[model samples]
Target chain A: MVNRLIEPTSGRILIDGRDISKDDPIALRRRIGYVIQQTGLFPHQRIGENVAVVTRLLGWSRKRQRERTDELLTLVGLDPARYRDRYPSQLSGGERQRVGVARALAADPPVMLMDEPFGAVDPIVRERLQNEFLRLQEQLAKTILFVTHDIDEAIKMGDLVAVMQQGGELAQFGPPDEILARPATDFVARFVGADRGLKRLSLSRVGDLELQTAVTAHPGDDAEEARRRTLADPFRYLLLTDDDHRPIGWVDQDDIPRSGVLTEALAIPMSPLVSRRTTLKDALSMMLAADVVAGIVVDRTGRVLGLVTVESIAAAMRPPDRGVGAATDGSGPDAARRLAAELAARDDQELGRTEATRA
Target chain B: MEAFIGVFAWFADPANWQGPNGIPTRLLEHVVMSGVAIGIALLVAFPVGLYIGHTGRGAFLAVSLANIGRAVPSYAVLVIVFPLSIAVNRETGLFDIAFVGTLLAMILLAIPPIVTNTFAGMRGVDPDLVEAGRGMGMRGGQILSRIELPVALPVILAGMRTAAVQVVATATLGAVIGGGGLGRYIVQGIARFDYQRLVAGALMVALLAIATELFFSWLQRRAVSPGLSGRSVRAYENVAQLGRVDVPAV
Candidate 1:
């Protein structure tokens, strides 16, 4: 309806306060980008031609079209030199989807309608494409209407989600955080699922948490000193680091010899190493999968910064009380209160999980 | 075996190469008749076939027309049109009775495959492609010319190949209706009891049919989109396979 592919029987669609029904549909469609689930690429055309479709229709010169095609292909993370001359049949499903997105963005339409754009790919590729598309959208900022049946995708991609119930009636409309935190109706709540708090974790990043400093020791450090330091700390494990301050592993106080130097062979394997950009949900999942109490947070250069424990993550998810500063306290009345709330929240999450499994 | 040897010996004789009734002239006549009949049948069938295929309307008409074209014997058509051509000639002095009758027969033989294949080809184009074209804001004509035609070209050409080969073989029937072609050699040889000429004429017809098949096969390959047919190596294999099934019923 937005692209004027099918005319609505009763209502008029307005774009920029102008009724699109009054505009020439071809001109309107050229000005608005459209993408569907199947990627809809013309098999007979080369990738270059597919990307430049709208540009050519708009009468761009051959040189301009070629330049734009190359630029768009590169923007979609496809190497223009390698992929431009290839046909759609030569590409993988994900590659074809990238080309589809490139084609839609060719004319740089002010509005884009994406209907399950990443739906055709596998989960890994879908996540990668979703991230790439988000990164591109950060730079472009085109007014986008993204449609997907997956609630996770809708929450992840949409700034303001418009949830529709059966029969295409709008159930609720608001920012993803609001929609997840305070669903407008019971249907909306059920649709978002009972694990809304867990889902919200995906929205927050590991960088947002106040990480605690892990007690560190080099491989050649005195084992007796490391053991003393480990016993003094609440977490009785000494993090062994290389010369560059990157984590190698952990050494338990019980395993430390009385007066010998620490060695790489003595340390147990470290927990999951997550970069600051990792989402809280992913970080927690990795920590759980590794059966560790905390994840080592690393910088871009892979140098260890600090550690993020599940307690700290749970503390972060609680309602902000005093300030960001007090939330970092490992043991206080506020921390105790937050821990109680976290326990209650975990119970609620467990209930939600069982309900989800039943459904 | 003796007739086959006699066929080669007839080709070796230089005397048979020289006049309007010679091997070369008769072969030319045969090619022209086939070409004319195919051209006329294409003009009559292509538009109707494309219309039916594109609109998806009159599907029954396409099927019924194809069935009717196939069911009517070419020999019967020749005899039927012979009287009509003679009547037209008597009324207007414009049409040649024998030529028109024979041409009509060959055209009737060619139409079924051309029409059926064109309709089937267009119908076979993925509807998703057509929908994509429409979503891209292509007008009806643009979608047909740019998207539908290119994708369906292979199947359509295969159909034309079938029709062309069939026409070439069927045009030999012109000899039965007082028309001139390589079929003259067969008719005369049979009348005079010359087995050598009969074998030579049959062999030439076979060679002509083979040449027609190869030419159209090449044309089909050239016309199809490379994306659909793949690269040259795979496409050559496809053409070889296409040859086995595309042979005319003759």
Candidate 2:
């Protein structure tokens, strides 16, 4: 019933512009992997055997099976040496889902259909798996159709959001931000939530944009001077740091002393120091919890890199309200079409450079 | 009552331990009859039961065949097999009527439980376990041998135990048909109204049956892991105590 429901009735379902439905279903199924919601796995079989079953059934030789199973284990971020001999009953839910994905990709499928694969795991593990999948998707470039009742998950993972209605009709279809900003109908609007604008920030990452500067102070700086700097600047806090320029803490304007050294005594420990590589979604959560307007973005060495303010987060979150026209162009549809062409040309140029490098 | 006690005391007396009327020979005959019958039943029923279980399609036919064997009373089997054995060995004139007829009757009595238990055990395996095997690309034969057989072993053993005890008890029927056994002593006692030998024969058969049952049950427990058997017992108990129950098609 599930296969029939997703089956293309009139025309072929294309992947990478190739009509694969007319081809052999065995071949098609091999190239299009699927992950069910419950991470359906054989509890009695060892994890490696579970992943290798499809490959063996497909008549891959022993050497090839070994190679492919190991490759898939690494691909799903599970060390084959550790997990190969264990059974599904012995694994955590997240690990089971990872194995599920590995098994689906057993034949090196170019397309993956995931049906709420992370639903069984706790939130922290789910988030890690989601991010890991995103990184994998970026490298593999597989055309993925991920299903979830979770609108947040849909927004976070989907490149092109396709909201399905109660009876499984396409309710809305567009980019994540566009669908969130202007839902096609009441159903979509309610589904994305009334605060859909805020939810969009979860899809944006800190690495996607440039950061703004903030007031900085050395640990040996006079407390009076740090207070004077905070009063003069628009930002309320001064970022305190060590002599080596690593961010130590921050001194709020109200907490600074008159004529003493600005040591750890005057500074509050930095609770929301997000790395520059952190997702805006994660940064926003930290900022919200800290009740601070901005987060200090640090490097690997904890150096005070820059700050992510509320305005940058808001700007990253908000979509241009004027539908498709405002999306590509600053002006109108003709200009927007030109902008799309230019972006495509730029992508083509980058591809050409990569090929040249390969040559 | 006084005469019964005197007879009992006479039997209990050490002087009559190996006395006349072939008392020692009768006890030996009883042990040999039961041991031979059980041995033959085990050899025949176990393999046949396993075969019927693996096939799984002809449950009604298999069950009917087994039930027919059981429905034929021990006396009937003895009466039927006696003449047949004599006719086959007529030229040799060496037919051991008592031993051979008792063996046939015991085999008939033992088969029903073995066949029924085997079928029930094989059928009782959770379908999900079989599906998991198929999904792992296991062939039907491999699934049956590696997964199904090992899991159903205890239940199969339980059935065999029941059949064994039943057969050992029923071997006494051999005595009435000129079949030499402790049953010969039982028949002699009844003819002369000498209750002492009759009570002794009856007690020996009861002890043997009880001992066989205990040994087989211990074997069954040892065949499967303790944890798995305990879980199965607990699960069955919970279902039984549910009060409003939907009976399954067993």
What's the number of clashes in each of the models? 0, 0
lDDT score, candidate 2: 0.73
Best by lDDT: 1
* Cα lDDT for residue B185, candidate 2: 63
Which residue pairs in candidate 2 have backbone atoms (N, alpha carbon, C) closer than 3 angstroms, thus clashing?
A: none
TM-score of every prediction relative to native:
0.81, 0.57
Candidate 1 lDDT by residue in tens digits, A1-359: 88888788888898999999999998888888878778989877778888887888889999999999999999999999878866788889999999999999999999998978898999999999999999999999999988887789999999999887755567789988778876887567767876887998898899999988999999888988888988999987889999999999998888988998999998898899998899999999999999999999999988999999999998877755446675354687877886676666766655543343223
Clashing pairs in 1: none
Deviation (Å) of B25 in candidate 2: 12
Candidate RMSDs in Å, in order, are: 8.0, 12.7
- Listed per prediction, chain B TM-scores read 0.89, 0.78
After superposition, candidate 2 runs with Cα above 4 Å error? A1-164, A168-185, A188-199, A215-243, A248-271, A321-359, B1-131, B134-250
For residues A177-248, could you state the per-residue lDDT of candidate 2 as single tens digits?
889877997557656765686777666678676887778888767778778888998888888888878877
